[model samples]
Target: MFATPAYAQAAGAAAPTGGMSFLIQMVPLIAIFVIFYFLLIRPQQQRMKKHRAMIDAARKGDQVVTGGGLVGKVTKVDDAFVEVEIAANVRVKVVKATLSDITPAGGARPAND
Candidate 1:
């Protein structure tokens, strides 16, 4: 076997290091997190907080709309559930978390009256 001798050559310049380099690598990730917090996480949290407060304050005679799309009047409100009258003489017990919208006593009346 015949092999040609090869000489060592200088390598290309290496990237710079230190805090600036670290920041340069992390800036995009940090920016993504910040963007997610403001555009997605923070708003969702605020909406959930508002929804929780509204659900916690629900009371009798309030017109409510369930996540299932049922519109009814809240005849009774418990710690974690509510008795909703979807129709005259027809009531169903539903979890409070399933209530998506709660209109105040004066907001609107149930369709069935």
Candidate 2:
């Protein structure tokens, strides 16, 4: 009236899974990393590179928007600081890294555009 473990012996007869089995198990993790790299990390890196190029190209007379939402014309540009004139004879010094956007001197494009 009792079942024996003789059938359970068949369970242990299976061979151990090899390296290919381990690799298959890792496939989803690898794919996820690749997806994250392409979808998130890579784009952020490219955006930061483009933003760095733009900051390096900043010069005097360029209209700049700061991180704080202040808009002004760049009167002087230095390696680390920029003198921005927000109003007639009113200027403020800001760190170059704080610049968010830059419009060249001839950027008379319609504001509504």
Best by lDDT: 1
TM-score of each predicted structure versus truth: 0.81, 0.81
Locate the minimum summed-lDDT window of 10 residues in model 1: 104-113
Q: After superposition, how far is residue 10 of candidate 1 from its true place, in Å?
A: 3.3
List, in order, the clash count of every candidate structure. 0, 0
C-alpha RMSD values across all candidates: 5.4, 5.0
* Predictions in order: lDDT: 0.92, 0.89
lDDT of 1 by residue, 11-57 (tens): 87997978999989999999999999999999889888988988999
Off by over 4 Å in 2: 1-15, 108-113
Candidate 1, position 13, lDDT: 94
Q: Per-residue lDDT of 1-113 in model 2, one digit per residue for the tens?
A: 69755644436566658898899889999999999999999999998998888888888999999999999999998889999999999999999998999888899633421
Off by over 4 Å in 1: 1-9, 108-113
